[model samples]
Target: MPARYCQDSPDAIASCVLEDMVLLYHRPSGQTHMAIAPVPEILATLDDGAALTAGELLGQLAQLYDLGEPEEALPLVEAHLAELAALGLVRIA
Candidate 1:
């Protein structure tokens, strides 16, 4: 399970209004880079530079996608995370 970068729109994903988004980038040589989205200037209360973890990311997904609980979202999140990591989108943190 690896992340496949949408070559057509590598940087088109939007970030949160109050939080930063994490992205895993895969290079042709089979390496992954974790690219954290920077908070937009217009967005307030998003100054912290801390990177989001899997659990935290699940929470974000729960909120953004209106899921009921982090537990429920955890599996999906983990799957995607693992996929991304496998494809050199990110490394397990």
Candidate 2:
């Protein structure tokens, strides 16, 4: 099975959209993160806290944005998720 990822606690994070960027405030770590494009979309899709594989995330994201090809976006999504995990915005499940 593919690895799954989930967002951190909803209460632990606050976010706002500024133009094309999303600013995320993580209460636990007292860190502010600036995200753009797919990063914001990825976090929004995981707002429900449901663990999802890269492919699953891509599917959801495709519905919200114009992602041309799932095959091409899978790797990019995975990379974003990994980065989010490192930033404490998400975790591997």
The estimated TM-scores of all candidates read: 0.44, 0.94
lDDT of 1 by residue, 4-41 (tens): 22122233233333235443333354343443421122
The 10 consecutive residues of candidate 1 with the worst lDDT sum are: 38-47
Q: How big is the positional error of residue 50 in model 2, measured in Å on the Cα after superposition?
A: 0.6
Which candidate number has the best lDDT? 2
- Tell me how candidate 2 scores on lDDT: 0.89
Per residue, candidate 2 scores C-alpha lDDT tens digits across 1-93 of 898999877787799989888899989999999999888789888889899999999998888789987788888999999999999999998
- Clashes per model (N, Cα, C within 3 A): 4, 0
Measured with C-alpha atoms, the lDDT of residue 69 in candidate 1 is 66
Model 2 vs. true fold: TM: 0.94
